[model samples]
Target: MDDDGLFTIGALARRTGLTVKTIRFYSDTGIVPSTDRSPAGYRLYDINALARLDLVRTLRDLGLELAVIRQVLDREISVPEVAAAHADALEVQIRTLRLRRAVLRAVAKRGSTPREMNLMHKLAKLSDEERRRLVSDFIDDAFGGLEANPEFVAMMRSAMPDLPDDPEPEQVDAWVELAELTQDPDFRAAVRRMAEYQASERAQGDTTGLHHDLTEAVRDRVGHALASGIAPDAAEAVPIVNDLTARYARTFNRTDDEDLRDWLLTRLEIANDPRAERYWHLLAVINAWPAPPSLAPVFAWLTEALRAGTSSRPTTV
Candidate 1:
C-alpha cells in the first residue's frame, strides 16, 4: 500500500491474485480504472478500484461477458437481476449440452452411419413443439376427417413423444426410430388402413368405444395360454378360444358363431401389424412411460386359434 492509500498495479495483482496484465486490461477497459498515476507514470489503484477488480475477476469466472460485467460495475443493472438472467441462460445451455451428450451417446451405441447420425442429431435438435407436430401430422394423415374410434384416436393424440432434457441413449434411439416410422409412407398407409377399417365399422353402426375390458380379457387369457405352452391349434386352446370369443361376442353384441369368429379374425389381422405395436413401444420409450406389454404374441395366438377353429368347421357346399 502507498502512503496515499493507493497501490501500484503490481501490488494490486499480488493482493488480488490476478496478474498485472489482467488488472491492466481491466483498467484499460474502464472496468477498474486506475485511481491515480505514480510520479513515474505507473498506474496506481485505490481500495475502491481494488474491489472493482475483484468483482470483475469473480464475474468473469462465472462466465459473465465483459459487457455485462461492465454494466454491473456501472450499476446499469443490479447484480441480482443479472445473476437471475444469467442463471436462466445457463439452464438453457445446460439442457442443450445434455441433449448433445445423449445424441453422441446414441450415435456411439448404434454405430450409426453418417447419414443416420445426421438424422438423429436433427431429430434431437427439434424443439418440443416441433417434435409434437411431427407426430400430430402423422395422426392427422391417418385419422383426420375419418370417424375412427374416437377413444383410440384420442389416446394416440395424447400419447406423444416427449423427450426429456437429459434423455437416455435408448430414449434418443426411440425418438429417432419414431420420427422415421411416422414419416414412412408405408407405415402411414398401414395406419390409414386401420383408420379406414374403424371408420367402416362406425358406418356399420358399431358405435362401441375402445373395449378395454375385452382387450384385457384377451391379453389375460392368451398370456396364460402362452405361459402354459398351449399351442393355438391344440385342443386345449378350444376352451380358451371359446371363452374369449364368448366375451368378445358379448362386448360387440354379436353371436358366438362361425361368422363372429371370421369377423374377429379379420379384426385381429388388421390390428396385428408389428409396426403398429412398435409405434406404441417407441412412444412409451420416448415419453418414459411404463413399457407396455408386447401384444404381438397375444394377438398372434388369438388369430391362429380363430383360424384353426374356422378350418375345423365343415364347409357349406
Candidate 2:
C-alpha cells in the first residue's frame, strides 16, 4: 500500500482511524507487530497488522482488558469464549446499576434524609438469601412460639415479601418501609398480641375466627353494600347486617344473639388495624402479588350497623 508493500504507522493510523501513538504502543507491546523498517527506521505494517489493530480496537470498545484482547488476537483462546465471559460480567454490572437507579429514584420521590438514604442503599444491596432471611426472622419474631395456629402461621409465611433482582421504584420504597416496620417494637408487639389472641381462640375450639368462611361472606356482601352507598346506620342496612350475622352464626353453629354479635364486632375491630393492612400491602408490592381488596370499609359499616341495630331495641322499664 505504501512505497514497498508496507504501510507506515501514520498511514495505518489514517486507514484504521487510530492514532499513531496508539498503533506504536500496540506494536511495542507486540500485540500488532511492524512487518518492516523503512530506510528512516520508521515502523511499517502489512495488511495482517491492519486487521489485528482493528480487532484490538473492537475488543477495547467492548470493555475487554488489553491483556485479554492480546490473548484473543494470539488465538490462545477463542473470541467467543472471551466475549461470553465478558457478557456475564456485564450482566452483573447492569443489575447493580439498575438497582442503584431504583434506590435513587425512591430517595428522590421521598426526599429522604441522609440516614434514610444510607439505609435504603444497604437494603437494596442485600443478596436474595439475605433478604429472605431478614423477612423470615421478622415473621418468626412477630408470630413465633405463641403456639400460633398452624394455618395462621402458614398464611403469614406465604405472605412473606421478597425483592426481585430488578425492582421498580415503588417496590424499593415498599421494601424499605417493610424493613423498618419489621424493626419496630410496637409493630412486632401488636402482631404478636393478635397472634396470641388467635391461638387462644383456636384452643377454645370456637373456630369462629375471621379466617373461617365468614371472611369471604362478609367481604362479598358488605363490599357490595358499601359500594351501593348504604349508610351503616340506615334502615336499609338491617337486612345486610342480618344476613351477615346469620352466616357467621351458622359457621360457628350458634344463634345470632346479642352476645355473639358483640364478640364478632370486637374481632372485626382488631382485624381492621391499619398496620396489619400496611403489612399485607407491602408484601403485595415486594412480591408483585395481587392486592386483596380493603376490608376496612366493610368492617366499619358492619360495626356501625351492629351498634345501631342494638340501640334501636325498646327499653323495658
Candidate 3:
C-alpha cells in the first residue's frame, strides 16, 4: 500500500484528493470499480483507480459533464479531446454574454420603453441567415433594375452589411445601430432617395466621372466651409453651391450645364439625412468595410444655405 497499487477506498480518496462521499458516488455509478473486498467485505481499489479518479476529479472541475467524464474514463475520448470540445463550448458561452452586454447597452442608451426593448431584442438576435436576408432585401430595393450594370451592382452590393459569426463589441454595437436604422422611417426615405438617384444616374447613361475630381472638390469646398463655421444660409453659400456644381460637371467630363447642375443639387438635397450618414458608419463596423468620408453634412450645409440668404456662396470648380 505504501508505494505499490491497491488500497482501501478511503486510502484511494486520500491519494486522489477526492472526498469520500464523492468517491462513493463514482463507485456506485460504476465510474471507478472496487478491486475486491477483504474477509470483512471492506471495499478495496487497484492502484490504477487512483490515477483514473484523479483525472475524473480534474475533468469535473473543468466543467466536463458526467456523461463526458465517463467517456474520458472509458477511453472513448482522450483528455485533450474533451478539453478542446469544452473550450469551444466556452467560446459560444462568451459570445452569448457579449450579445447580452450589447443589448443592455442599447437599452440604457435609448431609454427603451417595453415595446422598444422587445423590438431591440428581436433585431439583436437575428441569425446570420436572417441578417443576410435583411441586407439582401435592402440591396434588391436599391439595385433591382440596375444589377445589369456591373459597376453599379458591385458598389451597391459591396455596401452590404454582414455581421461576423463571432462579432466584437463594436461590431455588435454597429449591428444594433444598423438594425435601428433599417426600421427608421427617415432613414428609409433617405435611402430610397439614394436608390432612386442611382437609378436615375443609370438612366442618364453613366453619371460616373472617369475622375473623382468633382466629388473630391465638392467634399473639399464643403469641408472648408464647415471648418470655417460657415452657416449654410450666408451669402457665401451661393458660391459654394456654384463651385460644387461646376466640380460635378467637370467630374462627369463636361462643362457646367445649368439643368444638370440643378438636377444634381436637388438630388443631393433629397438624399441628405444625418441618420443616413450614421447607417454607413454602422455598416462599416458590421462588415469591416473601409471608412468613407461623410457627404451628408456637406449637403446639410448646402440645404441650410439654400434655405437662407445669409450663408456664403458655394465654391465652384
Candidate 4:
C-alpha cells in the first residue's frame, strides 16, 4: 500500500479483474473517483473507491444503466431500491421476449405470409382483457336478439378463449385463427343460425334432454352401426335407426312418426355443423382446455341414415 493507503489504477484493475481502461472510464465519469494521485500522475483509488467500482461492475453485469448505478453510488437511492426497480424492469422484458418468441414460432410453423404474420403478431400481443372483450363482442353480435337462454350465454362466456401469459406456439396460432374466425361473416352467420335454432327449441320447452338423448343414441348405437359397415339403406340398419328414433321421440315427448322423424332430421342437420365444432376446438386450444371428441361424425352418419330410412318408408295413401 502507498503511504496514503491507496492503490494505483493498475493495482485496482488487477484486484477487480477489470481492464485499466474500464476503471479509468469509471473514474473519469466520477463514478469511482480516485482518492489521490501518485507522483508519476497515475490515478490512485482507496478501499471505498474499490467497493464502489465493484458494485458498479456487478450492476452493469445485471443490465442496469450507468445512470441508475450512479444513483446507487451517490446514495440518491439505496442499492436494494435500485435493485428492486431493475428486477421489475427485467420481468417486463422477459414477458416481452416470451411473447415475441411465441409469435415467431407461430410464424415459422404456419409459414405465414407477411399479411398473416402481421395479423398474428397483433392477435398474440393483445392484453387478456382486450382478447376477452374481442371474443365477447363477437358472441354478443352472433347471439344477441336471439332467445338464447341465459344459461347458454353464461356458458359461452365462461368458455371465452384466454391466451396464457407465456403462450406456446400452438396457442398463438390458435389465437390467430380464432380471431379471424370470430370476425368472419360466414362463421358469424352459422353461429347465429345455431343460436336461433337453440332459442326456438328452448321456447318449446325443449330442455337439454333432447340433445343429450340424441347424442347418446347416435354415439352409442348409430356409431356402432357405422363402424359395422352397415349401409344407411340396408335392411340390417333398420333396428339401429328405429332404436335411435324411438329414444329421440321419447326425449321430445313425441311419437316415432314421419313428421317427428322429419323434425329430428332438421335438428340433426343443424347439430352436425362442422364450423360450429371448429369454433369450440379453436377456443379450447387458445384456452389450454382439453378438446372434447367431435360429435359431428356421429351426427352426420345419423343424418344420412335418417334421410334414407325416412325416404324409403311407405307413405300412407
Find the candidate with the highest lDDT and give its number.
1
List model 1 lDDT by residue over 251-311, tens digit each: 7667525677788888888877999999999999998889999989998998999888723
Candidate 3 residue-wise lDDT, 1-317, digit = tens: 53345688778877777788998899899898777776788777886787778878888888889999998888999989988999999887777777777777767766878887676677767877788678777657654665234564566566766766556656766787777667666666567666667666667665462335655776788889999987776666677766665665555534645455456657667656677678778888888878778787777776665555432223344
TM-score of each: 0.92, 0.82, 0.79, 0.86
- TM-score (C-alpha) between model 1 and the true structure: 0.92
- Give the distance in Å from residue 275's predicted Cα in candidate 3 to where it truly belongs: 2.4
Write one digit per residue (lDDT tens) for candidate 2, span 269-309: 65567778888888899889898777777787888888776
User: Per-model C-alpha lDDT, please?
Assistant: 0.89, 0.81, 0.71, 0.82
Residue 15, model 3: Cα distance from true site in angstroms: 2.8
RMSD (CA, Å), each prediction: 2.8, 4.1, 4.1, 3.3
Query: Which has the higher lDDT value, candidate number 1 or candidate number 4?
Result: 1
Off by over 4 Å in 2: 160-166, 206-212, 224-246, 253-262, 303-317
Which candidate do you rate higher for TM-score, 2 or 4? 4
- When 1 and 2 are scored with TM-score, the better candidate is 1
Q: Model 1 misses residue 308 by how many Å?
A: 3.4
Candidate 3 CA-lDDT value = 0.71
Deviation from native of the Cα of residue 121 in model 4, angstroms:
2.0
Poorest stretch of ten by lDDT in candidate 2: 308-317
